[model samples]
Target: MKRYAIIVAGGKGERMSSNLPKQFIQLRGIPLLMHTIKVFYDYDSLIQLIIVLPANQISLWKKLCNEHNFTIPHEIVQGGETRFASVKNGLVAIKEKCIIAVHDGVRPLVNRQTLENCFSTAEHYGTAVPVYAIVDSLRKTENNTNFAVERNQYCIVQTPQVFQSSILKIAYNQTYEERFTDDATVVESLGIELNLVEGNRDNIKVTTPPDLKIAEVLLSEREAIIS
Candidate 1:
């Protein structure tokens, strides 16, 4: 079975307080997006990769890939304005009848075990998602109004969301509202059954300056132990 990884890296770093996209930000001297890709590569070399970047920033991505001596032969697709559109673009690049995993490029800490689990589970089930059960009390706030909710009912969604390539492509092809938060939501729209597995808490999606600091600390500790 052919496995594909779509790394969506097109978000502008508005919250990151940088002119460049958040995925392009440096973490421990290397681009954060590169670290995300390396996780997939390390997990399984046989997995094919499709990276989505902002249309105007494709040139910059190519240059970085070349300069960093990136050896993976992955395809690059032009990203859309929203995350859903960017993933849809990637779905189009893949051929039919395979396994495909969509991942946020800013999440560099997805462990190899998680990738393996997602892919393994997805092989049998049409859709598989990594999710963590919420452990904290939850409340909904809108315009400073707070509403209480049952924490037991919620789970925090994480990525490397895996599905059968054919099914996923068909799901993405269906038009929907901008409310599609993730690939699982798209699959849910098609009335498909989704399988869930445990996700590591360490698998974080970087979006702000504080996230960068946390990632730096993680990388430093890892390297110190390795050396």
Candidate 2:
């Protein structure tokens, strides 16, 4: 079956306090986004990879590709103003009916097993979202007051959210809304139940300086194991 990944990376790195977008920032001497793309390719070389980037950053991305001698083939699409719009724009490039995995470009640590599981589950169930069990205490804040809630009732959603291409296309046809935080939410808006798959806690999105440092440590640990 044909496979594709839409890696959304339009953030401006405001949280990272960097001139370059967080995706373009170096992690273990390689661009964070490149590591993300590589993992998908490593899982299935035949999978088509499409990266959604801010309109202004496309040129810089290409330059980085050349500078890094990154030759893995992938398509680049300009992102829209909102993440919902950006994902919709990425969907424009997909033309076949197959498994499509929508992932965060900064989340480069998703393991091979997790990718395979998501795709396999999505292939059978039409939609699958990776989630980690919430271990922290839960709280509800109301009018400056907080109340305890059941942590077991909630899970931390992560990506490589996979779905059948046709299902995803149908979900994206609806008008964009501010409340649509993730692709799963959009699909749920259509009354479709999403399949949940286990995700790794290590699959962190590099959004801040601290996240970068954490990723560096993780990468170093992985390399140590390999060598």
Candidate 3:
């Protein structure tokens, strides 16, 4: 089946304490988004890559691509006010039947194996998302109160959430809602169960400065291993 990957990056870098958007921050001398695009390109050169960025940031991204001499082919879509809307915009570029994987542009560490597992599972199950078991103790807080909860009952959900285009398009067609935290939630609202596959813990979404440092270390280690 044909494959499509929609990479959503609308971060304003508020949490990262930077004026530049987090996705455009430098990682190992290249803009972070380029690394993300390369990962999907490596996974399947024929896979259609769509990057959804804020409308105002599109020109900056193109300039960065030219400055870095980044040549991997991808289509750019202007993002919306919300992640849901951004993803929906990215979906607009797809008009054919194929598998679709919605991913976070900041999560460049997602291994190829995880991508393969997600796309392969979604190819058969109609939906698939990667998840990693939580290692920290759990807590629940409400009304200015907090208490420990069972940690074993939950896991951290990661992206590259793959789904059949038919279901994804249908899920995105509904009006946006505050309760729709992620693509999986959007699909689940329609009573569609999502298949979860094991995800690599290193596939962390870069948000803060410390997160960027961690990504640099992880990327260096990966290069060391590869070389």
* Global lDDT of each candidate: 0.89, 0.93, 0.96
* Residue lDDT tens for model 1, 1-227: 88999999887899999998899888987789999998899788888999998889999998987888877778999998788889998988887679999999999988877888899999987778998888888999999799989998888899999999878988888886777999999998988999998887778899999999988887777668759
lDDT of 2 by residue, 3-104 (tens): 999999997889999989999999888799999999999899999999999989999999999999999999999999898998999999998888999999
On the 0 to 100 scale, the lDDT of residue 182 in model 3 is 92
Which 10-residue span in candidate 2 carries the lowest summed lDDT? Answer: 217-226
The residue pairs that clash in candidate 1, if any, are none
What's the candidate order when arranged by decreasing lDDT? Answer: 3, 2, 1
How many residue pairs of model 1 clash at the backbone?
0
Native-to-model Cα distance after best TM-score fit, residue 213 in candidate 1, in Å: 0.8
Worst 10 residues of 1 by lDDT: 217-226
lDDT of model 3, residue 127? 97
Q: 1-227 in candidate 3: lDDT tens per residue?
A: 89999999999999999999999999999989899999999989999999999989999999999999999999999999999999999999999999999999999999999999999999999999999999899889989999998888999999999999999999999999999989999999999999999889999999999999999999999999989
Native-to-model Cα distance after best TM-score fit, residue 166 in candidate 2, in Å? 1.2
Model 2 / residue 189 / CA error / Å: 0.2
| TM-score list, all predictions | 0.93, 0.98, 0.98
**lDDT at position 166, candidate 2:** 85
